[model samples]
Target: MFLPDAAATALLADALATTQPDLAVVHLHGDLGAGKSTLARAWLRALGVSGPVRSPTYTLVERYPLASGGEALHLDLYRIGDAGELEFLGLDDADARLWLVEWPERGLGALPVPDLEVHLGVEGDGRSCRLAFRGVAGESWLAALDERRRLRMLPEPSP
Candidate 1:
């Protein structure tokens, strides 16, 4: 479904804050400067992460300890040249962690399968996002975000 930039960002933050599930790994797929990192920053801010929050395009992973209560891991793989590098980062079996990864396709063949896929891309005024849940938990998580799955049929307000 499509959500305005603010709404989409809020939906993601709400999903993470409300559910409080064991693990949730979201992958943001899109081109460069397509709002992937923007989404990540919004999410981290919603989680009450203080101090400067920058893209992990260079160091790969940015770990944050939520001021209130939570933990988050954000990763950017756009600079990585090989999938094997993910293994070196020990992202192979991150079983119970909240991770937001960008440029996932670069490490698709190596990284762990995402629980949720938030597809973001350029649009007229704001980027469009498609949220897809992969595993059972993720499906349930999405259901909780959208109780009746009503957002799909609703027409977005024209900008």
Candidate 2:
């Protein structure tokens, strides 16, 4: 979908926040200024996160406690030199229900296969996003999102 501005990105994030299941892994793909963190922050905010949502660029991963009693892990693997580095991050120990990963390519073998992938790219002054589903969970979430959009009378993006 073509996200014409930050508001558009926030709208997409809101859709994702509402449509997602109890458990999900979402991979955010794009270059440095492609708005991956923006979407993540917006989604977290939409999910009732009231505190600061800092980017995990340095810490590698940041965890948030959700109002629904679940946890969300936002990971940025751009600084990792190897996927094996993930072992030290204690990913296996976390009981997070949602995972939002940036630069997932850097931790391919260490990370879980994403239920959904959001690919973002710069287009003029705005951004473009493409959603790809991996399994049944992802498909269901997309269907829910579509239904929500339809109910809101939002137009579908052109191919």
Candidate 3:
């Protein structure tokens, strides 16, 4: 879909926030300045992640414990030199209910398959977002999102 601005992007992210299940892997795909991080921050914030939501660029991974009782893992593999480096991130030990990963292509065969992939791209003065589902959880999440959007229960995106 075409997101007219950052606020529009945030609205989409918020809608997604309410539809996610207990366990989900989301891959955010986009080039630099494409608003990938903005969408991620908005999604995390909607999930009740208070405080600073810094980009995981340098740190590689950042964990946020949701007040709702689940955890969210935000990972940025932009600087990763090798897929083996992901091993130190200890993905196997991850107990996060939601995983948002950027630069997933860098992790390739090492990363877990994403339940849903949110692909963003620059389009004119705005951004374009495409949602693709992988597993059953993703299908369910998309169904919920469609229902919510269809019901017009979701808040309108800020201009």
The numbered model that scores best in TM-score is 2
Residue-by-residue lDDT tens digits, candidate 1, 99-149 = 889988888777667888888887766777777888887887877767744
Q: Look at candidate 3 and give me any clashing residue pairs.
A: none
Q: Of models 1 and 2, which has the larger lDDT?
A: 2
For each candidate, the alpha-carbon lDDT, in order, equals: 0.74, 0.89, 0.86
The clash count for each model shown is: 0, 0, 0
In the range 28-108, model 3's lDDT, one tens digit per residue, is 999998888898999999899999999999999989999877689999999999889999987788779899999999998
TM-scores, one per candidate:
0.81, 0.93, 0.91
Candidates ranked by TM-score, best first?
A: 2, 3, 1
lDDT of 1 at 14: 55
- For 75-157, candidate 2 gives per-residue lDDT tens digits of 99999999999999998989888999999999988899999999999988789888898899988887887777722432344
